[model samples]
Target: MISKLELLDNLKEDTGQLWGKMSAQHMVEHLIYAVRTGNGKLNIGCFNPPDKWPTLKRFLLSSRPFPREFINPIIGENLFPLQYENLEEAKKILEEEIKDYYRYFEENRDALLLNPTFGELNGSEWEAFHEKHFTHHFSQFGLL
Candidate 1:
């Protein structure tokens, strides 16, 4: 699974034809939110119960790829309001957030962040989650 940020440059508003309603800018902003969550900037709680986190995290950290039709329970079927001016700006912010994530983890190795889907995650777990997530979205836009 590819997790390269450079691959995101290949996306255009019209790029993805496979499935889902996300525009290119929406996808970038989504990624920005995800990185914020991992870096403790979002400060959200997990949706799953405590008992479910172990199982969920196991699934998350596994090598299996996310299915194309899969949808998060929180994000449902609708599109979210765009947060950036445009796709380019969204991509730039996403890059900044990714840099923040690296810096955040390097400074606070033991910090635990809530992932909404995976409960509390340490830096390494968040890293794994981000990689899998980026791979999924990048593949959706044919950037893989």
Candidate 2:
């Protein structure tokens, strides 16, 4: 399996995905937000009820890849506005964000962060989310 950081290695800006409406750069920018979500920089409320999180988190940490065309309840069907000017910039920042995600947990060993789908998650759990998410999007662009 490719590490999340390496998932972008060969992703091209115009690559057509097996599913979804996102362009390659849009996918990269989307992933940048994901890293922020778990690293204490971005705060998002859980959409699920408190009692649902344990089951959701277990599914997130599981080996099953996210189903193609899965809808993000918080984000909906539209793509978020892209932050960087281009694909290369977005990908570069995504790499930096992934590094920050790891560094943050290293410095704050017990810190927990909120994810809109999974409630509060510790470092290891966040890592699992990242793994699943990266695989999902990378698969979208056929990068994995």
Best by lDDT: 2
lDDT of 1 by residue, 1-144 (tens): 124988876887667646677877888888888899987789767788999999988998899987787777767887789978888888888888888899998999999999989999998898889889988888778777
lDDT of 1 at 57: 87
Tens digits of per-residue lDDT, candidate 2, 51-138, equal: 9999998898888888899888867989788778999999888888888888899999999899988888998888888888888888
Number of clashing residue pairs, candidate 1: 0
Measured on C-alpha atoms, candidate 2 has an lDDT of 0.84
Q: Residue 74, candidate 1: how far off, in angstroms?
A: 2.4
Runs off by more than 4 Å, candidate 2? none
Global lDDT scores for all candidate models: 0.83, 0.84
